[model samples]
Target: MTYTHILTRPVRFFGFAALAALLAAIIFAGAAFGTTVFAAPIERTDVLIGFKNIPGFAEHTLVRAHGGAVTKSFHLVPAVAASLPSAAIRALERNPLVSVVEIDGEFTAIGHSVELDNTWGVAHVGAGSVHHDSVVGTGIKVAIIDTGIDYTHSDLGANYAGGHDFVNGDNDPMDDNGHGTHVAGTAAALLNGAGVVGAAPEARLYGLKVLNASGSGSFSDVIAALQWAVDNGVSVTNNSYGSSRDPGTLVQAAFDNSAAAGVLHIAAAGNEGNCPGNRNTVGYPARYASVVAVAATDKNDKRPCFSSTGPDVELSAPGVSITSTYLGGSYATGSGTSMASPHVAGVAALVMAAGEQSASAVRQILRDTAKPLGDSNHYGHGLIQAVAAVAAVGDSSPPPDDSEPEPEPEPAPEEPTDEPDTTTAVVSDISYSTSGGRTNDRHLTVAITISNGDGAPIGGATVSIDLHRNGSRIASGTGTTNSSGVVSFTLKNAQTGCYSTTVTDVVAEGAQWDGFTPSNEFCK
Candidate 1:
């Protein structure tokens, strides 16, 4: 069962009514301010503007005065979505009623996965244990700002709360494509026992249709969704979508407003994989300080090749081969950081349901309890741990004071030694020793041996190791077991310091065997 996502390929939308009113502004904005629109056929320049404590009518008139027209108005967020000629942006910004203006950009939905077999993601993060305590994200409204949700699906309908459709301008936010439905399932699919279970199965779900059928949407629609999440007292908003470029000032401000309103906006770190430059390529709104950027990891706590890494990433989750709810009341699997983000969102809902309603507090709890992997840019603080987050839940009045001691790391799952048939698949022994101590000649050897109950060596087993120095992985390697079931990985040019190694055993037919990360400090 694979989970995680990215739905690339944005389709152009050109409904006659939405087009005719905005073409002039598109041309004007494009020509005047160096803004470019990838809009096909009808090039309309759309933008979201936050008003500066001004009357609604005055803000409306201001847009018209600059050759623009009001297409939509938000409920509580002092903002209006409109299309204006390029020349009008400066004037609108100059108006006392307008506080910020930004070009509406495009966005793509996403997914990430390692296997499509068993949906172990929910259990991997310890949601299984939290569920037994009856803290299943009940009453917490989590808005999935993706394509849309298939409320008709039996597992999701009861928890489905009505939402706005920023795409075609109607109340029905049903998902035309399957991306949003998948995201919804990951975050809050019903615990019906028949299909896959979600992280927060009982959490109220709202489908904010920002991305279109082609899995792409504009920045204005996203802002509208964000505004709705803020106005409605939504506990959390899961944004499993992103764009390469930063969204304009209006959207950024909207994110800030959402955070202030206690709406935890969780977003994908993007699937660009450091792009062509191997850079820190986290995208907006994940890159924004107000949003919790999420990175993707497989069940073994390994970062996928496509998961983007950067300073903006706040946490990681199981994204590879993650299986969850899908269109037509079915389940499907896919891969991308898009899938990883919703896991955190679901965990946030769980934290909120546990009585911590403050967004900052929830974020801090998540960070404090997360299982640290290594390297902030790659894995952030490490994979999100659901059990620890729920366990660390405290008063919602304010975040735990910095002076307070941080929570301890959650323990890994116990490795099963014998099968039902009494056949033992021993996880032999993982011994870490260092050799070659000279500067620039330091070497670290990680030996992993596997055997059966008969004490016979099991060959063909895969041993993947992560060498950690000061609790951070500084080097890693992969090796295969020999005929005697022993695999050794020697790190060349190893750092001259005490280091620990995490080894995993993939017993060919046993990819599920996530070797224990038994740490032993050995000096070079």
Candidate 2:
């Protein structure tokens, strides 16, 4: 598709002819590169290119300069997205002007991934509390871009809307396979008699059928689904799919465009649990910047054997033995990164129903309020909690006290005092250590002494200490320097066993004879 944007420039008048030339250049550029290589099973032949900070004219010139043929571009996204031949891709990658170059490839649906013994997954994320407030995703819409959804299912039909079937090139989007209906149920199955309640029970669902009965589809179908979401004003898209080792291609631009257009794209982080064996290997689309990559967790908040782990994994949700709507308007249980993805997608809708409209804003609220577990790889910032996420969406806390940057060292007084008796105090001694004890009773010891410039002990200096436990402030106290110029702070009941937070940010103060920032601090 061709896009025209009338960007405003600085407060300078351009001659009519100069403005005309720029417009004509952009028009020619759009026409010259108006369609991507639409062939199936074609990789390495088409490439997706992105450019940033370059003006429209400059982008046009740069593409042509590298012999790059433009197919299509999503001007709404930060990077000017385009397609190029293999040779142009190499040249573009080598060029300083291009921001990112990725090979355009296809994506296949990766079949993959919660609890109350029967519905623990719903309680795991606290969606019940959100439902109590009537925030059951009443006004939100989530698209399931999978095999297809059985809209006829008693549990899902109430919320099911119309969607396109990319597999058969039709608009009916019915389920030939059961995967889409299963994922759809997890995302937003309706609250009806004799069925499981979804994470966001009232959220709308649409099946943008991409995968066929065998649970697979090409990259182009994925792109078409994304375009459909963008055009249809979809609030969230639950994509329980992926492509292993697929270099990012045309779909990357599509993901970016979808996000920029205010839609959230949630995807399974992949189910190759330890397939790379000790390395966190995330697959394509899910690993893209614009997609919310979700990992899988169980009732006990543990990573299952099949869920992938990596830095790209954003958040985790219940995905083990999950029960949801199925074929024949029935319900069944399944697992995979695919199952894990819908939990987050449902939460996204709940957050939206609570009045968070911006896609970026909803993402931040979810990340900020997620259950913070120590392990990031398995549970990317920890398991997602729906009640917390909902509360965060409507949070009106006092804005953070960003006014205080870390205190800088004070400069020596410029004005000399009349009672100047030259005295400089140095830390005569310093020591710190952790006391051995069981988890219930441990302590931290920090000590410091002040001495005069002449090597004599100083006295009466106010001493203060700040103690932190696990990245949060835990304790602080002030001590007066004794006659011997010594002051100490001991934190009792220090935590022992399992990820102990070491005492950090210990600072000492004197009467300005000398200031000290201890060396033990490893502030990042």
Q: In angstroms, how far off is 60's CA in candidate 2?
A: 18
lDDT tens digits by residue: candidate 2, 1-524: 11111111122346999978866754664355331111121123555556665224455447645544333333333333333445567777777767777655556666643222365687679998888777788757688999999988889877876787776654678898888898998888876756888899887687899888888875656776777687666889998888887655446777887898999989999988674335676787888888889998878887877888888888999988888888997777887888889999999888887777789999888888899765677778778889888877645853222222113332122211122332544555656555556543365655656676566666665444345555554544444456776766555445543211221111223222322233332221
Global fold similarity of model 1 (TM-score): 0.65
* Residue 450 shift from truth in candidate 1, angstroms: 75
Global Cα RMSD, each model: 27.8, 29.0
Taking the tens digit of each residue's C-alpha lDDT, what string does model 1 give over 77-119? 5676666777668877887767788776788886444346778
Deviation in angstroms for 113 in model 2? 8.4
Identify the runs in model 2 with alpha carbons over 4 angstroms from their true place: 1-104, 113-117, 275-277, 397-524
Clashes within 3 Å, all models in order:
34, 18
* lDDT, candidate 2, at 28: 62
Error of 1 at 396 (Å): 14
Tell me the whole-model lDDT of each prediction, alpha carbons only. Answer: 0.72, 0.67
Best by TM-score: 1
Query: Cα miss at 423, model 2 (Å)?
Result: 84
The RMSD (Cα, Å) of candidate 2 is 29.0
